[model samples]
Target chain A: MTRLGRSAGRRPSSGFGDAPEVVVEHAGFFSHLVTRSTGRALRMEIEARLARARGAAVAVLDLTHVVMIDYACADEIVAKIVERTGQGGARRVLALLRGVSEHTREPIQRALARRGLAACAEGTGGRGMLLGEIRDRENRAWEEVTRLGRAGTARTTEAVARRLGTGDRQATEALETLTARGLIFGDGSHYVSVAVMARADTSTASADDE
Target chain B: MSRVLSVSPELDHQAFEALVAELPDATRSGVSILFDASAVTWVSPYGLIGLLALGREVEQRTGKRPMLEPPRNREVSGYMERMEFWPAAQNVFQLPGKQARRHGDSGALIEITSIRSNEDVHAVVKKVGEGARRILQGRLGYSKASVIHFSIMLSEVCQNIVEHAGSLGWACAQTYRWQRRLGREVAVLAVMDVGIGFEQSLGARNASTGSAAALEAAVLRGESRFKDRGRGHGLQAIRRQVLEWHGSLRIRSGAAMVGDIAEWERRLAAGAGGEYAPDRVSVKTGLPPFPGAQVMIVLPAAEESITPGPEAA
Candidate 1:
């Protein structure tokens, strides 16, 4: 991993140091696998850049150029670094790994699920949240859908259907399916998905236990 | 006191059966069994992983941590260390270790690894992907995309252990020339776990589909134990990937074993169409009860693909 580019200034809102973003470009592929050493070296390079900036900003692991990412490398680089946040750590920088393709995304997702860690990934329309972090939350579905904004405020069956290019019935079914998974909120006729709604009434309680 | 089960040089399914046959007699003697690999010079994925599955069974029957007498042959000992077989074994059965031995890329074998967590799956997937790149893509001359499917397929297949197997499992892979059938090369991956088998695990949720039907349901229908439809895509991905490459897949669990050995001649004749024909794949039943499950995917060496993705024209 090499320092290909970087963002200079901080976001106007948060106001934590400059909050400069470090962009790492991977060269070559052990057939595009980020192995243990590769991951460690990459993490060190990113950490070195992050040390210069204060406060927590999203660390975008730009993989626009790298073709593939495998599991071991994903764990060593992404998962391990992402784990180092909360309660008196050196620094807390949100890790937003930009995927080049499914080859990268799939392994990272599986790794996150395995470690019981939730990672905020960049999604369509610039909306993203910690995928596994909110798994236990009952209303996370509605919140995620709301965050989409593209799906609209109500997230209606017809609207979802139109967006997904499927039938209204299929859209309704998909909503119901998400509701069943406790990822979304559906009231048979309508749906409401928002950040607060997705949070569990008792944050400590397991939604699935009910 | 322990009854030692001396492993053969070629430690595959045949070797496993021989070890199992000796189990009853060993148990009757009221002593623990220790696997002796001192003589084993050659090991395949099936043999390496089958050792763990067998170890789990032995522990349950006798209530003891499985033991192994280190290989006397330097090559065997070196191979075990390089593959991280010793370290993974020590973790699973709770044994002591010698120093680390680094595995090489020259061989067709991917080192045996324990899959206790998703993290383990990740490490194995990376290694398997490297194997696919080197063996399938580089040596066999398969297209870049075809090799990627092998990685994805490996990921899905190995993930089953951590997701479904209540206890630990192991995975290994190897590539070699398939002289008799395809007249080219074939990559063999063998993964096994000793836990509540498919029938006990997902059979009730799937209407007691039994062991055989459950295996088929998982692979064919992508059935998950959870009602969440998003869940069970592992086997389905494996099925589709294997089919796309005209590979052979065998899943044996509980009382039955099912295999879809894609007919090579028909595949060549069909050419681009790649239609689904029932005769091309076969599923068998009443496979003499085995604990847990074993999945084997054999991808034969083929020329570069005309179509990039897994789908047909």
Candidate 2:
């Protein structure tokens, strides 16, 4: 089984120098998430592990091996995690979902949408997409930024505005919305895809192996 | 002193009323009850679990576990034993002599089981997972995706006992060839609890006149006692899945029963003077009060047939 935490690699610092990433994979532990009790237990376990990772650590929840997830379990596990991570406070964590199959994604998406929240999902091909509630313009901005990596010439807000055919202020708000939702990383001048950051970590691990 | 109640010959949703009408009133004193099943020929999953619920209620109220006269027909007895009905009945009914243990090669997709907590719900889902897939796809000819949806429906119904019912409940599922009712193979799921029924569960938030109104609010309206947005999605999910498969979902709580009757049931119910809404959901109020709730879901066999196989186990 392709475990989520194992794919996190040992080099958490490779992608975002200061902040580390923790992967919480329950595929091996549970074959099905059917009830709220199991979901709460898994969420608590994930929170405990993420707590140790300290400031602004990104948490990836892998659902690859989970054969099924019901709505109650999805609300407790996925929705609760996203809600807690999106809370306004210092030392906040970010949530990302990986290895979500088409069968298991609906309940998770419904759970998130119920709470009026959103999270980034790492697709099978390593690209990131938003799941749950997202504004149309904000989604477009996220797509544009993920395509324009954070390296080399920094793509400023104005560049994105011109690409989107929208005003600079509108573009800025959209990018900021994406940043606030933790779908992408913003450093005042440029935005980077969380998926890209994860990919970089994988590349760094492979290079070190060689 | 003891009272004898005769079990229906064909114990199913249609005969459920007759079975309940035989019950001693809830206020009846400590009089031992003997459930005579000597003439029972067949039992649906709903009837199987409803028997346990009824027995438990009588035992709890009268402070005496009711006695059961097992069905005399060999096939019916064998079928009940294979469904693990005896083991589950031991909890609520007093039986005679040594009973047969459950065999692995039974046709029941999910056996008589308890649903008290989330762990119990998880266990039921896991136990039925593979078997449900095979039966749903191979026998009922559902798509692969429909298998998971079926599991979700199972999980949600069982979870309802834990989250909403104040007490424990029983769940059972089986796939049968309904030669008389529909002339097709249908998967039946039944769950029942002698706990706080829909009236008390939803009356706290949504005002309703009676059990029928409460059931309608919950099943048809998708209302919940909790103010939380996701609290009521389970029933909605069940309703949607049943609609997709053109299945029937019937729920009875307190003094009434409500259901989105299937086409076949609608015609049968029409013959019996059942007034239906434009959407085919029918509600009956002012029924003899029964404690807790009873749910029955029947997923009719696929219209398109490919191959015939052995029944689900």
Candidate 3:
């Protein structure tokens, strides 16, 4: 399937069977470039890919074509970047985002501020070490939460606390927070992890080893 | 898998933490806890803060929040309101029923007519329970335990209608919405009956007693005169369950308003206890102009759990 066609639920037409990657080209306006459902799915797909990237040295999120942005999609994208980059000793993410509105860009910058990824600007050419550190830590933190959630017992608060290295109160509070955010769900005794939010898939720039 | 924890009236911070600690990790991370505070008429700030801290910890670990179920006990709601936690709780959980409605704004009007046969009480309870569960699930995504608790409270209230409303009159349930200043959702469930009101319900046992005394007695554990007959314990159970969840309950019978614990306490302290008297102690009042009783229940959304860090001293 073509990149855009793959996203909107179209089957692969021909010769594209070997293309494991999906890429969506951006149009000028937000509505034209990203629909709500497609935007969400894209964000999830990006995060999933990053998770699977494991210990790769660099992860590139190329968004350099034309574009407009919605707040929800923007927030999700920023969160993913911040989270992925925050993990220690993980692959650094180099975003190739272009034509981003000032309104959308400011929040993204602020989110990356604490992570040391703020110094790396769009189209900065060559790799930046600070960005890599931030990306690695963010990814590690996210992986920790996911790993703990998957391995922890779902029936009792104590089990969750132990996995997270927190007290019962903190564990319960964290559970509450996660539930509100729609990251996890529970049966009587156990919790099931749901898919993370996804935005759009973009063209791949070159893979970089920092 | 369905482990039940029966907390006593003497629940302390340590005991509460231990109970929470017993839950499984995944359940701890994802489960939505509903605190039924109706039974707890009074709460110390220290205890309340401890609970809040637990809720916070849960959120930080799992990144999910818990929903706080409103207590049907007026005293409990009053206590939460005094602590300024009521509005925050409502905002987080998005309370169900009457409190869900926007304050000062009216929405769809639903009228529920309860057929006053003792046998139909169960059916009515089931119907109300299903409706309530659907609404709550849609709004707050509560757990099965929370839904079951809600069902229990609804069933008890319906049972009261069957036993105390003279077995013949119909009870009406109305749904309304009013906007709250805090932007927290509020839905109202008002159940009214044109039967023997609270005065008569209580007076049937004692000729000179008022609605306040009957309400007080009804809510207290094991205070039912009909304990042998299997009728009065429902209200007490409802009161307890509601308080535990953090909901509010208001009852009006004849010229008497008996179920609002906050109002009752204020009046009693202000020396208005003797002036406002009812003729009977039943769930209904037999007065001519307004001959029935109306029970208005306000429930907040399920509560979010908090997990405090070990470093928190």
Name the top TM-score candidate.
2
Cα lDDT tens digits for candidate 2, B30-93: 6899888888999989888888887887887788899999999999999999988898888888
DockQ of each: 0.06, 0.68, 0.01
Interface RMSD of each: 7.8, 1.2, 24.3
Clashes in each model (backbone N, CA, C under 3 Å)?
Answer: 10, 0, 135
CAPRI band for model 1:
incorrect
What are the runs in model 3 whose C-alpha is more than 4 Å off? A1-210, B1-111, B167-178, B220-222, B227-231, B260-289, B303-313
Q: Candidate 1 or 2, higher DockQ? A: 2
Fraction of true A-B contacts recovered by candidate 3: 0.00
TM-score of chain B of each: 0.80, 0.92, 0.48
Residue B219 of model 1 has an lDDT of 72
User: How displaced is residue B162 in candidate 3, in Å?
Assistant: 2.1
Give each model's whole-structure lDDT.
Answer: 0.60, 0.76, 0.40
Q: How big is the positional error of residue B218 in model 2, measured in Å on the Cα after superposition?
A: 3.0
Candidate 3: Cα lDDT at A22: 22
* Candidate 2 segments whose C-alpha is farther than 4 A from its true place: A1-29, A52-54, A125-127, A151-156, A197-210, B24-29, B203-209, B271-277, B304-313
What tens digits encode model 2's per-residue C-alpha lDDT throughout A105-184?
88888888877988888655555678898888778877776666553213447667877798878878888777777777
